[model samples]
Target: MSLLVEMRGIEKRFPGVHALRSVRFDLKPGEVHALMGENGAGKSTLMKILSGNYQRDGGEIFFEGKPVAPDSPRAATDLGIGIIHQELSLMNDLTAAQNVFIGREPRKSFGRLDEPALNRQTADIFSSMNLKLDPKAQVDTLTIAKQQMVEIAKALSYKSRVLIMDEPTAALNDAEIAELFVIIRKLRSEGVGIIYISHKMDEIKRIADRVTVMRDGEYVDTVDAESTPLSRIISMMVGREVSEKPLDVPDTRGNEVALEVRNLKRGREIRDVSFTVRRGEILGFAGLMGAGRTEVARAVFGADPRDDGEILVHGKPVSIHSPSDAVRSGIGYLSEDRKRFGLATGMNVRANIALASLDRFTSKAGVLDERGMRETANNYIDQLGIRTPSDTQEVRLLSGGNQQKVVVAKWLLRDCDILFFDEPTRGIDVGAKSEIYKLLEELAAQGRAIIVISSELPEVMRLSHRIAVMCEGRLTGILPGGAETTQEQIMELATQRESAMAPVGEVA
Candidate 1:
């Protein structure tokens, strides 16, 4: 089998950060090569270099054993390289066909956009992939899964032989993932090489033929996907033996209820949901995608308005029309999409940590306490073991795990007794995940009521003292968490519709 793509001695550097070291990688025709690494381990950077989104400071790239230099994305595309970023770059307001051929749309007489020809070409490409998307459909109206199919269509339209997918399944559901795998297998059988980048161990196991691990911008090792244990791949990526201890589920019946919701409702996205979180307890919210776990959290935290519901803090009904009101009532929410909702990425850690409680740090004369902010930021930086040059470092420069910790620090500074972490460790490495697990446990030990919303069943079972399952925005059931719990039990409730719903406090 001949090599489809090869990269050697790849190096990239930013102002003060050495983003990549002497990294090397290769891909064979008709193979799925998985790229595994922690955030900031330089996997994306290397891919960008290969896809010509960024130029390598020093390296050599070859295509079909011929030396090539792709200095721009268009150049790479011309050479049959296509990259689908983690954040989809499609223009949502445009039609699917328009988005697929943004720059190189077919032209009619006098160079006018040939709309019919464009749609016809797009339909042809979609049909070739056995896809069911409408070329004339609005991108905004499509689901994330469908939008991804459009990205793949765009790639195939370029006649790309090598497709690079970064965290492709991050926003997709189980059914959507299965559909994507079918497309991947079809492409593989057709002799297309795929570069698969993801943090999900199970996904790589299911789809990859070979696995390459990178650590802190350097190539660690590449192993056979079928022959290597996940534990070994994880250790190679993190350079350590990461261990997991069984969660100790304590009896919290005697604990004080910190927060409670009765009949939370928000259109069809969220139904009449009700639940309670006791002090010193972790309540895991489990559900499938769009099952309304995050909706329940946002509703309670005042991030989204609920049509009818009562939120009580320590037995007193609280009026939370906005996030400020929720914060005043001692509630903090760490959103799943942290970059968009949780952190001020462009700002420094000190500024973000003090963001939720800036009023508390201001003097009567209206002066800001810079020194106090620094002290507080440094305090949490040390406590949380955040890897940063200083408290003044920009949050965007930090890895995904460290950025998440910064969000955790912000909530901690607000002194919120009730914290909701939605998809808390998504996109983080296994090492960082273990740390986050430890942090959540410690917070619970300190008598904080924590609500964790996660799509991963094992994470919910491992972290929560109790699991609350939702289906179509309704609370289907709640179960005790720990070794006694099975994923099957959660899934049963997760898919249970309103017709099969048992009232809250009524599920045995």
Candidate 2:
């Protein structure tokens, strides 16, 4: 394979922050390079410079043996370089075709939007990629997995020779991830150089040819993916030998029941969902996509309406019609899409942390308690190990892991006893994931009941005291979450659905 891109001595900086320190990376034609690092390890910064999202403070970039400087995203695209961000950038209201060809839409002679032409073009791209999607369908109506495919189609439409993908499978299930792997292999076979960044070690070993590790804003080492051990790679990234710590399943049966749902029915998405979570316990919800794990969590949290159900906090039935009601009943929900539902990206960390409990910080004269808010925010930042310059820093400026921590802080500040964490470590780095797991364990030990919903079987098995499996909107089974629980057992329960039950409404 020929050299496609060579970035040497790349350097980047922000006000009072040295983001990247003389990092180096190289890519070859028909190769997938996995970038491994902790959350502030400069992997994203390096990719941003390459994609022209940010200019490099210092570096030499060579493409096809020629020096080139891409000052804008358009310039990068024109130069056959494209990036698919961790967060999907599609417009919710627009059709897939419209979003794929947004800035350069075809126009009729009279200056009208050439809708048919755009749709046909998008259709062709999808067809070539073996992606089954309607070009005219609205993006918001599509599933997260489908939307991810559309993002790949849009990036490929740019005729990209080099592609950068960040945490592409964070939201995908096992089957969806397999499909994406097929697409990635197809792209690689076509001689497209790919820079793949993900925290999943199995994925890196399966998809990447070369592995690069970065630590503390500096390059650590690079090795062949097939040769280096996953443990060694993780150690290089975190500068410490990191191993999976067994979850301590404490005796919580004697503890009081924190939250209990009985016969939770929400128009088929949640059917007869009944469960009990005790204080000082971690309950894991495991299932495939459309299996209704998230729906159950949402119904319990009062983010969505429940058709027929009874909720009990501390063995006392309570009415919960909205999120505020759930909060008042000592419940908090950290949504899977944190940027959309969990945090206000435009606001500062302190403000977002105190958002849910603003009433407690308000004075009798309607005055805001700035000092109290800051103190609480700083306390959680220190406690949770959230990486931020200050409490006043914008939430959007933090990395994915830090953003998740901020959400955790918000719910903790609100003093919720029963917390629903949907995909808690999604899009977070491996090191940061370990930290989050430790924090969750600490929370459980502190007598806060936690229900974690995740698509990753290993994660569910590692974190829960008891595992609850859902299949097709029904509670298939529950198993002990320790050594006895295997992935095969979870898969069996995940696909076990009752044929007698009527089909429920569709979920996007």
Q: After superposition, how far is residue 330 of candidate 1 from its true place, in Å?
A: 0.5
- lDDT for 6 in candidate 2 is 95
Clashes of each: 0, 0
TM-score winner: 1
lDDT (CA) for every model shown? Answer: 0.92, 0.90
- lDDT value for model 1: 0.92
Off by over 4 Å in 1: 502-508
lDDT of 2 at 490: 85
What digit string (tens of lDDT, one per residue) describes model 1 on residues 1-508?
A: 7899999999999988899898999999999999998888999999999898899999899999999999999999999999999889999999999999989999999999999999999999988888988899999999999999999998988999999999999999999999999999999999999999998999988999999999988999999999899999999989998888988998878888999999889999888888889899999999999899998899898988889999999999999999999999999999999999999999999999999889988999999999999999999999999999899899998988899999999999998999999999988878889889999999999999999999999899999899998889888888888887899989999988777766654322
Worst 10 residues of 2 by lDDT: 499-508
Q: In model 1, what is the error at residue 131, expressed in angstroms?
A: 0.4
